[model samples]
Target: MEWLNKDVTIYDLINDHYRLSLWGLRCINIEKTWGLCDEKKLSEVIVGLIDSGVEAEHEDLNGNVIEGYNFIHNSRDTCDEFGHGTNVAGVIAAKKNNGVGIAGVADGVKIVPLKVVNKNGKAHIMDVVRAIYWAIENNVHIINLSMGVEVISSDEMNLVRLAHINALKVAISKAIENSIIIISSAGNNGEDSIDFPASLNSVIAVGSVGVHKVNDTFILEKSEFNNSGKKDIIYAPGEDIYTTFINNTYSHTKGTSIAAGFVTGIVAYMKLIDPKLNQEKAKELIFKSAHIISNHKEEIPFINADNIMISMWREKVNK
Candidate 1:
């Protein structure tokens, strides 16, 4: 999908190329899923999107964006140059009622854009660590990381441990004082083990799932670039998923990135419902409510957002 310029319109693409109908089945199902949760009301929470950058002024992401920072260049405007971050951000909280483009998973939530990568779609380990520290310092309720590095360093691992401890402490304190949640993307390398941060016991590791045509079964699969393991990874819709606002245009990108955004949106909604919910409880809610899809029962596990949200609502009402 080539863009006319940096300010292309969704209507222009639709009228010229017919890109919207490419994934007709998936688009229809996504619309249905949005319709199911629209009545739940998710406007009261804040979520942080940690990635390359975001198009904060995009029509579908205007008022929903709160504040943003770029750790790559240490700037305040975390604008998208690689377009990956904008797509991930749109998945979490693209504004609704715009009557132009597609809606996000959590339309009402506020997005705190944290840019940690550069235009080449690369980020340094120190930059990511600083971004995490910044997110924690800023009291971000939920942080979504869509990027991953293959090699892990001691310093990086130390930072990961520090983030995990900080997350746990903050979550516990929040449960006792305020209530917060943290979510991270399960890496995109399709391996037998999980990566850092996501592999950390504190962060929620998210995996990818594809709707396979054979036998009508939804397969909890890993992306070719995802590192796999028996870590605390949960699966979400990740294969060939449609995201929003790329290079000032709309496009579909596949990775654990979108899946992590999906989970971030849900966690934001959950926080909105129960402000006192801690990280552990939130994780428990996600795991206990997730739909099981594995046959062996010993391999990695996956999650169904629709089911998990329903279960959370039921639990809330029961309580």
Candidate 2:
């Protein structure tokens, strides 16, 4: 609610629940049929959730929430003051097979909460830079950034470049070679270009797509909140999306933020399956496996978790 000003109706919430249920079913079928990754063993990979914070005590997230840090106040508890972080976290690693709430895209993975933004929905470049550096030092496999700045700063851009270089070097060095995948939201500005690091070549920029409730399929039309162009890499369910933890309880919200989180969850799942995969390979796999939907005869690539996992498996077999 901190980021969005609109209110969600009950109808939207029910529709989201329905779509999520279908998505969960598809994921289960994919996993069972292809042996994507051992659900029991996938928790070994630690993914860094860099955002406001996480509702660590949330019933659906408590078990998977591992180590966490608060760069905002430099304290221990990274409890989500704003509900955005919790919603993002839930998308990434909310415990699956619990038969309650909702299933995450990568429920098998572990999360390392990195609180870079404070409760007031504000964050500084220095804190974000520090958080990225900390993630690098801590051996976080994938970093999910659901927040961004209106104007790109030299220092912040430099930090993102540094993180990308370090990740590349680490991948090549073969020493502590964990691929650091950076996923960012393609800001809700609905401009011709995306924002900040997401616009950068190194980060995976995600746009949003609205799905029709009646058929449970992506609405081919793009939302005004979505950012487009070459920088806009992929799209996901972001409009009227129902996620865990509202302002205080639970409700539906919409933005490119959720789309980025959706992609982050898929990336986490990919990492779990092939821990040896490099960042370049991961990025390529995501793009290659995306479901290209046509909007007025124009192809719009959207995130496809099942396709990505299958492609990775196929690559492994071929090799």
Candidate 3:
């Protein structure tokens, strides 16, 4: 194929923080997967970022952001008042090789900035459900949810809470039925339980892994604040991640929220390479290609972007 011998290096990797700020990207081996396809095709992959909102004018995110609705105020303005959405968007699609800020995992993919949360970092369950249905209607390729409702004790589960959960589940089911990949952060609570939406069976759950240098070599360790569960969860770099911030600036943040963005960015590329890819196949490839952080099978595996991309590439060509 044309991409096999394509000059990948032509795509700039020299953004100001490429070396220093993008420790998470390096950990996932994201650079090796660049230039694997036509940049224009990659641009067609859209990720619906359901969060507070995005600063559309942010230097690193301006052109890469697509129009989306603000469910909070029922307006067109998606400016991120809380700044969390901008952080996650930066982790997923910050401009590459701008020689300005840090680069994202999939620089070519466009982000659909859906505002489901408010400035106080609070989101209504119905708002999130509406955003998912909106994304399904818009036919986005992926949905990256960096926010979720915390899991409460079983004794506290009430009919109202269950009804809300079911509402989100139904919306998520419709998205998946339309072949939209939904990924959510496991949680930042550091508990053994995953958060809602992510805890849903069909959604891909992502946890945070901290990158540390041990004896001059980097290692992936589970972040203390990353929530864990027994099933269908993966890990990615989260600690000290430097990405785009509001006000056309940048900052370092950490959480499973950032981790979910990393997976979403990688999955965007996978969808680009294999348009036929769906939730089941994407999750299979992700879990199968993941690197085991420890010897235990139950330990959440960290994402290996290079491995999964190559696997997807081979599958595309083999067919």
Predicted structure with the largest lDDT when compared to the true one: 3
Q: Which residue ranges in model 3 land beyond 4 Å of their true spot?
A: 1-12, 153-155, 213-218, 295-299
Q: Which pairs in model 2 have colliding backbones?
A: none
RMSD of 1: 7.6
Candidate 2 global CA lDDT score: 0.68
* TM-score, cand. 1: 0.76
Expressed as tens digits, the lDDT of each residue in 173-285 for candidate 1 is 44223344666677776767666557667668787765544355444444556667666677666777665665557887777778787788777766766677787887887
The count of backbone overlaps in candidate 1 is: 11
Ranking by lDDT: 3, 2, 1
lDDT for model 1:
0.65
Tens-place lDDT digits, model 2, residues 5-68: 1232222222233344334223222343224477777677787888878887786787788778
Better of 1 and 2 by lDDT: 2
For residue 196, model 3's alpha carbon misses the true position, in angstroms, by 0.9
Per-residue CA lDDT of model 3 for 1-319, tens digit only, reads 1212234332346555454657677678666688565666778899999998999889888888989999988999999999999999999988877777888888879999999889999999989989999999898999999988887765788988788887888999989999999999999988888998788878899989886555665556788887777767888889999988889889989999999999999998899888878999999999999977762223557898889988888877897
Ranking by TM-score: 3, 2, 1
Q: Estimate each model's TM-score.
A: 0.76, 0.80, 0.92
The C-alpha RMSD in Å for every predicted model, in order, reads 7.6, 7.2, 4.5
**Candidate achieving the largest TM-score:** 3
Q: Lowest-lDDT window of 10 residues in candidate 2?
A: 1-10
